[model samples]
Target: MSQYFHSVTLNKEKCKGCTNCIKRCPTEAIRVRNGKAKIIKERCIDCGECIRVCPYHAKKAVTDPFENIYNYKYKVALPAPTLYGQFKNVWDINLILTGLKHIGFDDVFEVARAAEIVTLATKRIINSKKLQKPIISSACPAVVRLITVRFPNLVKNVIPIQSPMEVAARMVKRNISKKMGYKTEDIGVFFITPCAAKVTSSQIPIGLDTSLVDGVISMKEVYLKLVPILDKIDHVENLSCAGMIGISWANSGGESTALENEQNIAVDGIHNVIKVLEELEDEKLSDINFVEALACTGGCVGGPLTVENNFVAKNKITRMAKLISNTAVNDISNTLETVDVSWTNPITYKPILNLDNDMIKAMKKMESLEKIYNDLPGLDCGSCGAPSCRALAEDIVRGFANETDCIFKLREKVRGLAREMMELEGEMPPPFRKNEE
Candidate 1:
């Protein structure tokens, strides 16, 4: 099994263990125990939902510090399309790209430009191949992980194309190396990420064995440094290479729109995506040609690490996208033709939710789990730190929790013990008999 490296982590000091994260976690990957939130290593998808919903700011995404850029001889900033949506009242994308250079990057590459290439590549694939119905986009790492853990059957439906970030990283590194006579190793490509999923993806890629981007810097962290410099730079020497089609990818429905497919559906927010994926798995949406599922609401702009409000940022991106034209590069076919966009390795299902590795043992455990679940109150009250009664039963079978953790069960047990104590007291010899003698 591959070792999991999660971006989302708990800060023990800040966690109130109020069951907020456990309730919100789609995969039931979290449990509140001993007054702290614990993430199950096998089940965590790094969706950053816990980080977003945590009231006490206990959940955090681990990202590379800005100073880590100095580790490379040559640094390139691969800004996500969502980064353009961060700055309020800024329409020109070049200003944001240039601002990255001011922050100490040797060169700036737009992940959006690579998004344009991906758009073209995806279109080509859709046209050429008779793929499974409602082919899911492989762009969202969190969604991919979700499918792996929860809906393993739909893994085949996921498009095998590399993400825009990876494509851009490869292109930028190769181009920079050729131009500046620098080795590819010397040129470090850092992705300016909008969520913890991207951080985890960069560290341990899903489809690919290694990520082209060297490090991931959270958008919230970069926003602080970029905003002050956005105004200071008078003239942006390097204009944005990506057009509206690519830049619109920051918001929901952008990818579907770019695909120009009438039968495509775009779903945002992890829960909504899960619902749609469930429908797809049930073969309910076979008519649809494609499914653009973004883990974050309103797409990348709404990511947990982003500084701006998702709705507001989406509006800004929409407004900016209107002004920009699709004039970047008319033909990405040549690049797509040469590049290896397909997955190098196969993506297998992760049976994290399964009771056991052994079929017989798993079946036995399932029977026990069902029995335990039936015995519970089935309120899904989350009082026991698990999301639902079923989840608590699973935890109990897994030895992470017991029936006593359930408040109702504990209450009933306490009442039974009290009754037994009363019955034993009634049967006991009178204490005053010795004093009378």
Candidate 2:
């Protein structure tokens, strides 16, 4: 069964045949062809790394417009824990929340509160032996998707818990619907997202059959509209329900701090996260009590949204985390005991890559691919739409690419003509030699 959602999209007309995305992609899901870029649907993790690295800003993430909120009578903004770090030098969290109302939202809910709950729940997950060794963090949808596509062997290591984004969506709907006397259908919870992966998560939830979050709006798009009215929104001293541990969710060290187990470790950036997970797969992480992984380096501060520099924003967040009183995540765990904080959605165990499936068909495809690859000049030129020459060969075998996919094949024709000209000159001298014989 093919599962696709309107998440990350390509703006073909704007593409400049740049290899920026090909190199930056963690999953190597994109290929450059005919001076344009295309995404392999099954392989894309929707990390939005392409969107961030594109010089032309050609890569785009599909999202429901802000006007879609009118579909429901009561709309709420469930901003991700990462969203809070977007604001710099502004200590007041309510300034951002209140601004959501002025920008057409009816109410706001902090996803960090959900993180506190998730931290507690994940602790139980770690303690339980229902999963394979070194359970991977299910927080980043892109990372989860990466595991499914490129590293199917690691899927067993993925934690079964739904992401905090989904958890927060469920909490928001439950709280608002009961308190405000509104039905679940009447309340729309939109996430203020920093990356496209979160948008993908909302559309095709990793662990859940359906998503609780209604829609997603990019922090980049929202910030463009919010920056102009920063001073106008009425500010309260402490509108944030989250303590320091919750706010720390925006950084790499966030999970370790929130868990406060002393043996926990937090890792950020896709490359680093993958490395640590690999080490864990080998049981090297048995000594460590916990692992927090983030796809983007420096955590949400390095997300594709916000105008502030990531390093600058990270410094600001570090200071902010220190100022707030440290609250134990266990307190939250104690409160949600038997409160049904477990994932309300159904979880599926199917592998996305089918790596362990029958190898006969794959072997045949690989054999044919090797022949085609040998026939063509081995240039990793983006002209074939694959990231490299080797990738084109793989795509051809996978049935997603064709023989004419290479522009270098046409270049070889010109080289053939030059060789023919050299042979013609030798033929003229050969005629004279035949007459002498």
Local distance difference test, per candidate?
0.89, 0.75
Best by the lDDT measure: 1
Clashing pairs in 2: 31-385, 32-385, 33-385
List model 2 lDDT by residue over 190-298, tens digit each: 9888777888888777766688888998887777777788787655434467777777788778876765677778788887877887787667778776667788878
- Candidate 2: lDDT of 10? 88
Q: Runs in model 1 with CA error above 4 Å?
A: 429-437
Worst 10 residues of 2 by lDDT: 347-356
Worst 10 residues of 1 by lDDT: 428-437
